[model samples]
Target: MTATGGAAEAGQGPDQDPIRRSYDTVAQEYADRIGDELAGKPLDRALLTALLEQLTDPRAPVADLGCGPGHVTGWLADHGARAVGIDLSPAMVELARRDHPSAEFREGDLRGLPAVDGEFGGAVALYSLIHLPPAEHRAVLTEVARTLRPGAPLLLAFHRGSEARHLTDWWGHQVDVTFHFLDPDAVTADLTAAGFTLRAHLDRAPYPHEAETDRSYLLAVRS
Candidate 1:
């Protein structure tokens, strides 16, 4: 699933938004293929555990923003956080709910989240921000900050680069989505401007079986 905004209005309007439509079209296949991806990424699990550990109230809801098939969300729940998965695609949300009944999933936009101010204890946006254009990065981050409590931990992962990749076809299905490779320094600046204080930043080369792009992870706290 994908989480994005700045291109259209909120709510389930996939017919009007190419990104949502594309994800909806491939939601099932994406879940089938990527739902268990975290099993192979030890660093991802470690970071997620760190995020949960930092939350002041472990019972307070932790949002898995742009949570595709709810695998990460379910992982957080299993690890003791009250995890809620939010995605822009209705189909993705449906599949997440169907597969991970213990965790809650909602259909919402990243730019305009369907959450009240300071509703979440912490949040994670793994590879979700790449779907958004650079100009809208801070806006979405600001929205995320608005929904998180002060000092709430936020973990973000993205492709590390200065290039933008667009896909017109994926997994035998027609799609129109652009994945933005962001610079860690630029994203750190954006986090600061969005009311977050960076606590950790790490970059790593992709695993041989993974996409051929460098990856960056940032751990920040709402301030």
Candidate 2:
């Protein structure tokens, strides 16, 4: 999180940009802190299991978009899915590869994923979409839809609200990043616009030891 100017001001796109660098700077500490988060989150694990159960081919490839440290991807792999973790930070990708050798890991941007069209049987983006601006949500969801087979499921999770929070200091690192809290209805509309049929929409208060914001999860099928 060296002081790189705002990505927009720097004329750099989202790929390999400030957000990526910010995450890269704190990747190790972030991984060490949150890597095993699912263990404490029963609802998250349940939702993920639900997503896996919806997959038409249990062994088919499942992309973990914005995967950090590969924990979720590893869980998917352990649960009988061909899980692949993808992230924008090379550092995160490296750590993921190191930690989860059984599952594949790669560097990729959500706006333009590194995969063939309709290649994924399912996808998950837990707490990942909050990094993108709301204006870009629809386009990103469309890109995600493009990578999934017909009727493939997507499980998306995000902070639920209508506010943006910028962090300049994180775990003693000077990072530049913004987390956008999103409305479930708006995201549902974006999913519909991106050719997804909504299956479920859920929201819950934060569990103790979690961030204070409420969280939203949407399960949808690519149509």
Candidate 3:
């Protein structure tokens, strides 16, 4: 994958600016911890299965944005989608490539994707958007939309929240990392602003082993 500077750098405020840096610092540990969990977990598999059901065609190219360790990307490839994984952290990209040899993994920023316009048939921004505040959501969605063909499927997953919250968990790498959560209606609004129509949404309590949190999902289509 090609690399470049000047990635839009739009739609970020003080509270959210530190998040990227935190993820960069913890990229490796984050991948090591969550990679295998997401790969074989029944909860994640169920979500992917549901997502695949909404896909319009069997053979379609997919972009797995913020793909950590290529678990979901590899799954999509196995299911007949030409999948490519992209992430902001180079270490995460490296780990993803090492773990999932069949799929393509690239170090790239979501705010400014290197993908050609209308290149992907679908995109998955799973659990990645939670890092940004609500204000930046639409801009990121618009960027994702630009890479997808009209009517292409896009699945986004995140924890449901009534307001933005800052967090510091030691599970990943060193520096403190913060995540922002949004409610379902807010997510739908952002998707609509990005020229997508909500197809289906699932709100389920995470499994027993999962941490206690409000989880929500949305499967939308480009318009």
Candidate 4:
């Protein structure tokens, strides 16, 4: 069955390495495809603009977690903010560095980011958390909170629906990758449990490839 996000499921499995390996191998293609679309009209940019409007200072440090090809990182840098991009795939990090020379793209896993504690004023993870098990969402959110100063803003973008179904990552080329879709309400609960206050929750129009029924976004602030 096609993957779907839903209310807390009872028997979800832990994140495995096969998915990471698949992504690493296809990182270049993934970066290329997503980069082209995002560069044209970035979802992260639109959300970030809204987020920055609420910030007291837009120049503060902001991290683009799971930043593929550094599209949003480049946007943040261009807008005069201290922006850094982090991704688990070395190929993606390489491409992001080459394409966005001005922005910093580091190779790291989001499950355990290497960002300095409380150094960032904001953070974002566009479609990056979907692979995590539902149970880990709170831990990941806590990790995100740890890297930001108190009251730092954070934006997490993910596809939404109603159950935990696993499917191959279908960007073509026959790679075997999988991800868990997140339910918006459960994600919000995870964020709140991680010490963040709900700021905004939006179900956006699906981007080109995203099935119209499964696209969504959530923006939150650290309390």
Best by TM-score: 1
Residue-level error in angstroms, candidate 4, position 145: 0.2
TM-score of 2: 0.93
Using all chains and alpha carbons, the TM-scores for the candidates as numbered come to: 0.94, 0.93, 0.84, 0.84
Judge candidate 2 against the unseen true structure and give its global Cα lDDT, from 0 to 1: 0.81
- What are the runs in model 4 whose C-alpha is more than 4 Å off? 1-16, 39-44, 164-171
Error of 1 at 3 (Å): 2.6
Q: Give per-residue lDDT, candidate 3, residue 44.
A: 58
Q: Which segments of candidate 1 are over 4 A away from where they belong?
A: 5-16
- Residue-by-residue lDDT tens digits, candidate 2, 1-223: 1111111101137443768778788888977887888899999899999999999977679998888778888999998899988887777888889998889987777777888999899999887777777888898889889999998999988888999889899889988788778899999999999999999998999999787889999999999
Clashes of 3: 0
From the highest lDDT down, the ranking of the candidates is 1, 2, 3, 4
Q: Give the per-residue lDDT digits (tens) of candidate 4, residues 94-201.
A: 777998888887766655677778878888777777766778778878888998887888887776766554555456645454456668999999999999998888
Candidate 1 TM-score, C-alpha based: 0.94
lDDT tens readout by residue for model 3, 7-82: 1011233543454455555656665556556544676577677666666655667888878667778887877778
Better of 2 and 3 by lDDT: 2
Which pairs of residues collide in model 3? Answer: none
lDDT pick, better of 2 and 4: 2
Clash pairs detected, candidate 4 = 5-163, 6-162, 6-163
